[model samples]
Target: MKVYSYSFKEGDLIPTQYTCDGLDISPHISWSKVENAKSYAIIMDDPDAPIGTFTHWIVYDIPSNVLELKENFPKKSVVGNIMQGQNDFGKIGYGGPCPPRGKPHRYFFKVFALDVESLGLPAGLSREEVERFINKHTISSGFTYGLYKR
Candidate 1:
């Protein structure tokens, strides 16, 4: 499996519309359909954050049939049966890149194919909490990244 975006390519600079300086919406995300994938999960984080790794998005329990997520999704606990968790920004759903000015930070968009239909985890989980569930259930993973700065 592999994740890619129509808005930006790996290692490319993310658009301002997806940043705190702009619209603060999530860019479109798509991935190859993995065989035997019962469900899927997605997380986006900035390891270069000043306060350890900061999560921008935490979503799980996406039906296996979903291979793409549209941009500017609503901030809700559950949308179309997918469970969304809180990010380090203390909010639910996607919070776009917002780094201190000067250096650009790398934002990683990770996708996981799971062996189970659901993680059985609740929504509004922190990044760490979501990771705990992801660690045990992920069968395969792929990632793509983009750069951003204040």
Candidate 2:
């Protein structure tokens, strides 16, 4: 499995539309070639956050049949049974890159293939909580990174 974004290539600067300077929206993500996965989970984060690793998005319980996530996904806690957890911005769903005024930072868009159908966790979970579940149920993981700056 691999995580990728149509909005930006790995190691490239993410588009402004997906940053605080623009629409502040989540990038369009796509994954493929999953094997024996019953569900998928995604966590988009900026490890370079000034306050330590900051989570920008946490989505879980995605159906294994899913292949791609469209751009500008809803900021809802729950969308069609798929759950969106809170980010560092104190909101559910995505909070795009908003690094401080300095050099560029790396944002990781990580995807996990889980052995279970759902994490059995609730919405509005913190990144650490979601990560615990991801660790327990993950069978495989892949990621793509993008650079961003103010």
Candidate 3:
């Protein structure tokens, strides 16, 4: 479970493109060492969110052969024939970080390697629920973090 992206680096400031400062779009992502994974799940969230856990992005059912997701990928859009679930913004697709106007917040980008090809979930599932679902059937997982401040 390795994660790579053109987005902000771990502990680096998130670009404005995914925040209120820009397009509010999602960054591209790729992975490796799935280790026999039949499918994959991706969840991006901010635990530093003023609310508890805030979902920024949720995607699942990615085919095992896929290695990357392009920039500005939509929540409901399919990449390599994969499907996306709901995010905390109450929409499907990636939502960039928008922390409060003071301290920087940490955004987590988590990926799950699953044994099943699909989780059979609908398009608008929340982050917590998605977390539970992924944890229930994950074979391998890994995560990277990015920071942002408003």
Candidate 3 lDDT over residue span 63-134, tens digit each: 777766778775565554677767766777877887779988888888889988888776566767667778
Write the residue-wise lDDT of candidate 1 on 1-150 in tens digits.
879999998999999999999999999999999999999999999999988899999989999999989998788989978999999889999999999998999999999999899999888988888888889988899999999977
lDDT of 2 by residue, 1-150 (tens): 778888899999999989989998888999985789999999998888889999999999999998778999999999987899999899999998989999999999999999999999999999999899899999988999999877
How many clashes in candidate 3?
Answer: 2
User: lDDT of candidate 1 vs native?
Assistant: 0.93
Report clash pairs, candidate 3: 75-92, 75-93
| Model 3 TM-score on a 0 to 1 scale | 0.90
Which numbered prediction scores highest in TM-score against the true structure? 1
Deviation from native of the Cα of residue 122 in model 3, angstroms:
2.3
* Model 1 RMSD vs true structure: 0.8
TM-score on alpha carbons, each prediction: 0.97, 0.97, 0.90
Candidate 1 Cα deviation (angstroms), residue 109: 0.3
- CA-lDDT, candidates in order: 0.93, 0.91, 0.79
| Ranking, lDDT, top scorer first | 1, 2, 3
- Residue 90 shift from truth in candidate 1, angstroms: 0.5
**Model 2 CA deviation exceeding 4 Å by range:** none
